[model samples]
Each structure stands twice: as C-alpha cells, then as structure tokens.
Target: MTRRFLFAPLIAVALFAACRPSPEPGAGGITQVATIDALLAGAYDGTVTLAELRRFGDFGIGTFHALDGEMILLDGVFYKVRGDGSVGEPPQSETTPFASVTHFRADVREELPAGLDLPALEARIDRLLPQANRFCAFRVRGEFRHVRVRSVPAQSKPYRPLVAVTRNQPMFTLQGVRGTLVGFRSPSFVKGVNVPGYHLHFLADDRRSGGHVLEFTAATSTLEADTLHDFLTIRLPAPGAAFEKVDLTPDRSGELEEAEKNPAVRD
Candidate 1:
C-alpha cells in the first residue's frame, strides 16, 4: 500500500543558525489562487487549473482540489504529497483551491548551518530578510537530519472546518533524507489572505515522500530567498456553492494556528 511507510512523530529540540544575504528586492510576482480563510472554512473544491496557474509563477505552495494533498511547486513542476506520505506528480489538468506561486528566481543565496530546526531557520532567515512588510519566497535544498511533516486525508462533501479535518491528520517522519523545502514568508497583514508567518512544504530529492513540513533539522543545506518586490494577485475561486456560501467574516487566526502548526490532535 502507498500508506505503508507512514511513521509516528519524532520529538527533537533544535538550535539557531546564521546567514549572510545580499537582497535583490524584486523580480517575480506572487499569484495566489484563493485566500487561506476560504480553505480554513472548508471550501476545498478548486477552480483554478494547474495549467493556467503556471502562467502566473513557477514555484510556490498550496493544496489540491477537495483538499486531497499537500502541494509543492518546484522549478515549474507540481508535485503532490498525498495523505499516505507518498509523492506523485499530479497532472496539470488538476485544479488547486488555494495556492501561492511565483516564477522563482533567487535574489539572495546563503549556506545555512547544520542542526537548525524550523523555528531557528525561520528566525535566522527573518534576520537576513528583514523586510517583514514584503513577501519572501524561499527554496532550501540540502540533506536533512530529521524531518516531520503531515498531510490530511481527502475531504468529502459537507466538509468540516480545516481544524476539524486535520485533528486526525497523518503524520510522517523522515530521517537522513535529502530534499528541498518550498514555501513563503508573508507579512502579518496577510493573516486572512495568507499565512502570516512562514508556510512551507517539503519534497524529498527522490520525490518519493513529502508533505506540509511540521518541523525539521537540517544537516546541511543552501538557502535561496527571493524577496518579492512585484505585484501580488489574489484570484478568487470560480463562483460556486462551496466558496460563495461559506462564511469568511470571522477571525480564524486561532483556528489557522491549530490547523497549520499543531500536529494530529488525535491519533
């Protein structure tokens, strides 16, 4: 079975790292398919085809229609990290309900230190890319000492909020794996529009396993930060009952925190 390799979460404390950067303020635009609020509200059906999404940018992160799997768009290729912890290249015909993409071009490059965990890495990078008000898309490639990631199962109709769906999300643990972490650092003002902090997805070099990266410690890696200085486009989903009828007025940052940061609340 494709789900054969799923593993329990592994706990490990991580350390801080340092970086050197020379920013190239602008190059590509950031195109997002739908707002994060919509996804958190259980509007899982997608309207934007990956084929069309390619027109906007090449590298980014998001999920598939029906919330089927985690998405990793690297070097113009779209890869799906399934709930089973297996990786596959989904067809361009498939649509994404929520996604963020950019024609990734490295503006600053740095070699990160060993044993740096997610928080530490984010902290280090934050210092280097101090433009907290601007969007930053990064690609971190290297060998990982340990990686913990998760992906929720495909949701059926009459969908529950994302927090509800991920309560029993499948978690995976990978050690001694080589991969690339793809994600973005959005401004705090983008809370409803996108993740306020960092939202990252990982894909192993073999492209055989990956998911929404929960935590990790890098053994060795290189960082590419693209400080986006171009325009930002937020595309609305096609008019449909799922998106149109859903209530998005409430503040769900608390909900989003649990959904994005917390691991499976239940087995």
Candidate 2:
C-alpha cells in the first residue's frame, strides 16, 4: 500500500515528459533533463526517456530512473554502471531524471600528460578553455594507471534523499584500464540547476564495467572539449507535476559536495 501510494506522483511526471515534444535530432547546445536540486531532494523517478534524450546529444553523463546506477552516454549509446560495478547498454526505453548532454564536436584537442589524475586533468582542460562562464563538454580517451568510481543501487518507494543514499554507495577500483571519460563542466551560476563543476562518468573499452568517476591517474590520454554557448533545459513541464513539488529552496551544495567526492581520496 505504501509503495503504490508513493509511486503515483512519479508516474505522473514520467507521462508528462514523454508527451512533451522531442527536440530535433542533432541539435546544438547543452540539453539538460530536469535539475540537480530535484535529484538531491529525492526526485528519482525518470522524467525523460533515453530515446528522447538521444535526440539531444551523443555524449554526456546522468543517472538512471530510481537512481538505479550511474549513466554514461558515449558515441550515441547509453551505458549503465550498476552499483555492483558492472556495465551494460540500456535500452532506449529507459528513462533519466537528470542528464546533461551536447553534440560532441571537439573544438580543442590536446594530449594529456601522463600521471594526471582527475583534478590535474580538469585543471589542464580549464587552462585551455579560458572562457569559464560557458559550459564545456569533454571526452578523454586512453590509458589510465587506475580509476576509482562509485555507483548507487536502485531505490524503492519512499525514497531517501540523495546524500543519504550515497552514504553507503559502492565503489570500485580498476587498474591499467583503457576507456573514455564522458563529462561536463558547468559554470558556478548553474548551481541548483546543474552541477556547478565537473561531473563525469566512465565506461571501459571492453564495455564490461565502469561507474561515476571519483578519481583516476591517466597515462598518455588524448582529450577533446566542445564549447557550448547555447543552453537548453527541459524541466518536468506538466502542471502540478511531482518533480515540480520537490522543494528546491534549501541549499544542497554541502550535500552535493559530500555525495560527489570519494571520502578515502582527498587529492
């Protein structure tokens, strides 16, 4: 009875986002489904289907419905990194509650120096993209000494807040692997609407396993970044939608910071 009661609203939002007009395929700019604040507040139900999301862009990061796992959309395919550290391609019918993607035509290409971890890699890319205000989508492909990632298990009804869910989130460590890091860097102004800084997800070369990126030391990797001047956001457009009811007023920056960074690593 409790499960059915809680699921009613989630169903409403999904129906609305589905009926909303799909964006034209091959569109430019950053298209984000829903907002980060809502996700933090426990808006786990998906508001946008993968098939519709694919029309927006080919490269980006997001989470699955019910916060089932991490998402990596690379090269026109959607890959799921489950909490158990397994990777699999999700069907187009799957939905996403929060995602940010853009057409990935690299405007800058550079070879990253070996031994650069996530922070160092981000700093290097930041130097290349001096226009800090605009959004930048990037992909880094090549060898890595090791990469640490984490993913949350699927949630049931009466969902707890995101920070709470991630408290026991599972983490994985992969060594000497080759894969692509699909990610985005948003301006600080997008605080509640999107992750203000870098948000990335990883997928292995063999398509076996990967998850939300925590830390990594790259070895001779090549990077490509695309600068997007235009921004598009598709919220749950239905009137009186459940996602619309999620209270987003409180500042969840502290919770977000805690959930995103790996505790054991502070480099």
Candidate 3:
C-alpha cells in the first residue's frame, strides 16, 4: 500500500521596514544594505576570500574580518577604505574591479513571536517523509530553479531513492548550485518503506549521468515512534553543470540503470 503526505501551501508574506534610499554610515562607520552582486564581486575581486563567502548567508548582516585583523560589519553595502584609513564607497565598477552588486533577496522572511511553538513545524515535516522517498530520479527544468523528479519506480531489489531540488530554496544558497539528490539507498530495505535516520550523500547534477557534482546529504531521525525522520541537508552543483549516475561498488565506473526486479534486503 502506498501512503502519501503533503505539506500545507506556504503563505508568502511581505515585511514592512523603514526605507532609506541611500547608505548611512553608522557610529561604527559601516554602510548598511549593500547590493547582493556587489558583495559577491568584491569577494571575487580578491578583496574578500572564499572563506569569507562561506561565512555570510544571503541575509548579509554579519561581521567579517578584514586583511588587517580588524572586525568589520558587513551591512550589505559596497564600501572602500580610504587612504586615511576611513571607509567610503570604493571605486565604482567601471573604474575598479566590480561593476555592480547583484540584486539577490530572499523570497520570504518573518520573525516568529516569542512563545510561538516551532516544534509544530517539525512535526508537520516529519509526516511527509514517506512521500519524499517514493521517487528515485529527477531533472532540472526551466529558470534554473525548477527541479522535477521522475514518478516511476526502479525495478530492482534495494530500490534507489532520489530528490529533486530547486534553486529558490535556502539549500541552493548554501551549496551554490541548482540540481537534485540521486542514488539514495536506505539501510533498511522494504519497497516503499520509510526508514528513519537513513540517508545517502550523493552529488547534485543536472543530468543523471554527466557534469560537475557537489556533495548532497539527507537523513531522517526519529523524535518519537510515531514521528518520522526529516530531511537534514541537500546540496547541488552550480547552475548549468551536468551529472551522470555511476556505479557505487568496487569498480565505480558503470552507468546507473533501474533494476529489472527488486533485490533482496540487506541485513
């Protein structure tokens, strides 16, 4: 018997904040609200390092270290250190290394009021584990943000499980890629059975067979006997990359294909 669980439609809400068109230097001499693209370009221009890139999230409100070991507040604005050691708008893109900061913003943000129960959200997601385990293949579609998984099942023992991921989610920002989870296997085997705390780490790629791959990991853990495990993390490669499935055994070079019949469960 097949069991399915679905999540409630996510309601999109907008937050209202005081609008300031220009940057204002605060007491600490930090510029607030820099463009997303400019921040990335500055990092790429050698003013910032990959290590810095990994520290900041999409929100862009955090503290980062400069070359001189001083802590600077990254208020999401482009700034330049002057000859007098003061901060100001660095040279513009045409004159300097970066052209403009990219406009990247999150689709939704909300502050849960104090005393709001967060465990309820976790409970709701735990109920959907069975549904996520049903599919085993996926593809990246239009806009580089849509991920589609095949609805068919594999014909072999120890069925493979797959998950498709879109670029609009937080996982995309963390991994810097647009792809899907492929070649997942459960430690416990029963066709269509949901195994708690079992997951596989695979590479995310556009195609199931060829391209650059990034490590994607997923797992389910039991909160209680009735509550199922929820997905922990999923990663994919940068946009436009392709990936092909390969065998995971000793040879690790053969193409991946669906089995004719399900294989016996592992002990």
Candidate 4:
C-alpha cells in the first residue's frame, strides 16, 4: 500500500522508532477513498466512481457526490440512504466525495451494555481500543432502543458549504430497531483531514432507514472492531476547473465539528 509517515522533526526519531512497517494493500487495512479536506473545501462533485470504490473495501460510510444521499456499505452492498430516509442502491455511475472502508475482519468482538447513548457508547468503545493513535474501524450490530440520524438533500452546482447544507439536513429517530453502525475512529492529528474520534453511520435491519448517526441507545448489541495498522491511501478529486478555483485555504474544523455532532448547528 502507499504509506506516508512523515513525522515532525522534533518527534521524528521517537515516533519512527515505535512505528511498524505498513502492510501491503488488501491486507486487512483501512482503504479510504477520499480525504475529508476535499469535502470541507466543497468538492461535493463526484470524483471516485462507485465501481472504483468497490475495489477498495466494502463496509464503510460516506455521502454521495453532490451530497445527494448518505451512503452505507453493508454486507458488500452499497445502499443510498437518502434524505427521505429511504434506502436504495445507487447506480454504478454514482460517485462519492469521501469514504473509508476495509474488508472488515474483526479483531475484537464484545457485547455492549444497555441504556448507553452516543457519548456513553463512544466512551465504552474508547476503553476497548488498543491504542489511541492506531486507526480503527467499527461495526456494531443488534437492536437499538432508539436512534437519531440525519441526511442532507442533494445540492445543485455552485453548492453551498457543508455547514450550510447540514443546517437544513433532515433528521429521523427510530425506536425499537435492529441495525448496523458503520464508522471509524481516526486519530486526533487528522483533524481537518478527517473526523477525529468516532464518526458513525447507521443502517436498519429492514434496510429502509439510516443516516449519519447523531445519538443512539442500544439495548443488546455486539461491537466488532478492526484495528488497522496499515497506512491510509487517500484519493483526491480530479483537479478540474471548479476544484482548482475553489479556495481550500481556510480551516473549517470548527464548523465541521459542530455540524457532525450537534446536528443543530444552524439552530
């Protein structure tokens, strides 16, 4: 796999000494399709084709190009969980701006406790992590007492920024349901490059509903995690006129953080 581990000069010696060799591609590692930086910079136009996405990994979460719908990769199938909360298969022509996937070979599996909301559930998972810096992908399956999610509608060209789009996102809450939560816990250093900490998306058992998970209370669920030691492979959109003209110099970390966790940034 293509690996990039250029540590800062101050910590290069110590960090390099502790780092392990990156594994070859397709070897139980996280294969992310695009960078969050592009999304934050408003590269909503489709870049990587769906056909190209499947070649990387199967279980992951992302949004369709133009933010048309939320994406859920479950059981090797890509489902477009749209703003109306309807789930359907997007065409092979559909594309994604950002996505992270892995073959999903769980190295750890355990039962989760009941009555835990998003923060509690995250804390529980945090305790189980082998290390803070290593990449980890999660797949939690089972019944949920309650779940709250949000999905944004497709935007026209000359699209508004994601923060504005999220402000108008449609939210849904379902009770007494079975589903799977697909997500990853990226290192804090990634910050603007990707969402640090847990970023999860949910898909129901009936495959009728799902979106970006805001909150959830699991009754009895199993949490499966794949610890990724392999380096990340990032793909950027084909630099076209629109991509080249758009200014990506500003840091949108604050807005992205609010949009992601609160779901009420506009309120």
The TM-score leader among the candidates is 2
Residue 103, model 4: Cα distance from true site in angstroms:
1.5
- The superposed Cα distance between candidate 4 and the true structure at residue 14, in angstroms, equals 28
Angstrom error at residue 238, model 2: 3.2
1-53: candidate 1 lDDT, tens digit per residue:
43443432211111211132213211377889878998999999988999888
Worst 10 residues of 2 by lDDT: 233-242
Cα lDDT of all candidates, in order?
0.87, 0.87, 0.21, 0.81
| Candidate 2 Cα outliers beyond 4 Å, as residue runs | 1-26, 265-267
Off by over 4 Å in 4: 1-26, 264-267
Worst 10 residues of 1 by lDDT: 9-18
| Model 2 C-alpha lDDT per residue in residues 115-182, reported as the tens digit of each score | 99988978887899988898899999999899999999999989899999999999999999999999
lDDT of 3 by residue, 1-267 (tens): 122222222221112122432232121111122221221212111233323232222111111221111111122333322212233333222122111111122222222222212133223333433444322111111112222111111112222222111111111111233322221222222222222222211122332221111222122111111111222111221233221122222221111111111112211
Candidate 4 structure, TM-score to reference: 0.86
Candidate 3 local distance difference test against the native: 0.21
Q: CA RMSD for every model?
A: 15.7, 9.7, 21.9, 7.0
TM-score of 1: 0.87
Off by over 4 Å in 1: 1-27, 264-267
Using all chains and alpha carbons, the TM-scores for the candidates as numbered come to 0.87, 0.89, 0.16, 0.86
